[model samples]
Target: MSAWIAAAGQALLIALLAPIVTGVTRAVRARLEGRAGGRIAQPWRDIRKLLRKPPTSPEGAGVFFSAAPVVLMSTSLLIAATVPFVSTAGIAGSADLIVVVGLLLLGTVALALAGLDTGTAFGGMGSSREMTIAALVEPTLLLAVFALSTRVGTTNLGVIVAAGASDPAAVFTPASLLAFAALAIATLAETARIPVDNPSTHLELTMVHEAMILEYSGRDLALVEWASAMRLAILLGLLANLFAPWGVATGTTWTAVVIAAAVLTVKMCGLATLLAAAEVYAAKLRLFRVPELLAGSFAMALLAVLTSYILA
Candidate 1:
């Protein structure tokens, strides 16, 4: 029962904090570009307004179009529950690394199918680009995680983090450093950041994730947008907790839990700020250039795995 409560709390926290992360990124980007940004709560406001509006399914669209948002949001919540943020006691057994990756891919596929169901040119185009990126990105993500799993001898996320925490120096080793780099690149690509796909842009030709949901309005759009933000937060949180694992609680002590929560928040803010800074300075790559980025990430993962084996 305690474990269930902790997992539920973490899920709620992810949903609420996700928008703030996105807002912080936008605010930082605006400041860098010499413009005044909207309020930090602007995303929350946008979502609230969107939910108040009526949803309109385009002509010829099927039930999948309506079903996509629910599935996406549910999947994101599930991933959030599985990732250890403040405590590992609740979720360690149920969510292995591979299962987390699979959940993310499943969300991507559902969104892509929703895009296709709309039968719009922009939707189809976005679906194609999204799937292409997914195909390239997932293998790199898996390989990077596999590198860490190999060193720790478990594909379980919680165990990997526990092992790393037991030996802090493990994160500074060659294999770990390389894996972090690879995961960082995968993060940028997975979150549809600049140099991969511009999150702020709605241009059909360049948009990958956003273009797919162009037809959704009202509550459906709100749900999808909120889910995307939650997914980003979950991924960033996992990267921080898994790699650092300094303050995260292994037991259920209140003090340890509080410290873990605080550390996770600080880490997330730092990562979000870094992402904003990168987006401000970076240009979006051409569609054809995406494969090169993924390929480089793949090489980094492979290197990490090899380094781990050689060092061991």
Candidate 2:
């Protein structure tokens, strides 16, 4: 298969699987808590219902408010198109670490700006908190990936993953373990998961992501929610492939691509299951203590970098 075809396939697969991944987490959490969760397709139903409604904007909301959802969705689609989830043969030169990181940041900033544009106290407060956490989160994301880049000798995600596939031992090293831990924590913060921010919480004081989107309604809200789900799926996909790329496609065979896609789904669902279990046992840290958690992740990422360099 051509790289472009592979990329398109990967994007579509991720898009379709994003909602299911979210539902899996919620259902798993519900099961662990002794409640029968709704169907695994509940997120898809909620999104479809939201899309059928008309979008409403807050009074005095400007371009940022109207444009943020599109911007967020577009950035996510772009990342999904470029990132090699199923096949390592991504768009030529499009999966650079800096570029992917920048895309993630762009979506993040767009949402933050939208939150601020609402002129609500909660919006501003959430934006402030998001930026603070982002300041710490972004660096750890880079450093954790940087640790892998050192061993691969390039910052391209496709290259790093391909290298991991060829040398499985390298992926199981001390450096890889530290980087995985750091990225795992950063993913939790980025996705507003437990121990960072509670996705199901409605309490104003406890809400982080929900606060920013409180003013959104209808299709605008749908886009934001869809994009958030996609972001979580993408990050989990990244985590799965980065540390355990055993089944990722490295060739141009269509069969390999199909098998790889199946493998990506399995990995993402497995990770989501583990994440839900962790959330069940984990309590949300206090607002003031969030930075300390991020600090610990950052330290691990830094050490991963140093460890990779020294080991090399």
Candidate 3:
């Protein structure tokens, strides 16, 4: 019961904090570009306004169109629940890292299907680009996961973090460092961030994710947007907790839990700043060049795995 409560609280905390992270990243990017951006509270306001409006389905849209956003949001929540934020323990019993990756893919697949269902040129184009990117991303993501899992001798996320927490230096090896780099790149691609797919772009030819949901409006759009934010937060949290799980609480004591939460928040903010800085200085790659980026990430993952074997 205690575990259940902790898991619920942590999941809720993530959902609530996700928007703030998105807002901060946006504000930071704007500031770097010499513009006075909207306040950090802007995302919350946008979501609330969106929620008050009615959702409109695209012409010829089927039930899948309506269901896709819900599935995406649910999968994001599931991913959040599986990750260890405040504690190494999670609510789900089979919350393996592979399962987490699979869920992330599932959400992407659903969104792609929804895009195709809309039968618009932009939607089809986005779906094609998205699937192409996904094809290159999943293998790299899996390889990175295998690198870490092989080192820890377990696929369960909680166990991996707990093990890393036990021996923090073990995560500083060549394999670990390489895996982190690979996963970090994969995260940028997976989240539709700049240099892969710019989140702020509306150019139909360049948009990957935005084109898919271009027809969605009102509450559905809000949910999709919120879910996107949560997914980003969860992925960065996973990267942080997996590679730097030193401060994560392994016990159920209140003081430990509080300290764990505080550390997690700091890590997230630091990562957000890094991402914003990277985005500010980076230009979005041409659609064709994205495959090369993913290929490089895959090579990194391959090296990380090889290093893990040689060092082990």
The numbered model that scores best in lDDT is 2
List the global CA lDDT of all models: 0.86, 0.90, 0.87
lDDT of 1 by residue, 1-312 (tens): 377777777788788889988988999899999999987789999999999998999999998898999999999999888677777776632578888889899989999999999999999999999999999888888888888888778788887787778886653466787888889889888888889999889787799999899999999999999999988888888889778887878876667766877888889878898989988888999999999989999999999988877776
lDDT of 3 at 30: 93
Q: List candidate 1 stretches off by more than 4 Å.
A: 170-172
Off by over 4 Å in 2: 90-94, 170-172
Global Cα lDDT for candidate 3: 0.87
Candidate 3 lDDT, tens digit per residue, 1-312? 377777777778788989888988999999999999998879999999999999999779997789989999999987776577778764632378778889899999999999999999999999999999999988888888778778778888888788888976564477887899999999999999989999998998899999999999999999999999998998889889888887988865778778988898888878988999999999999999999999999999999989887877
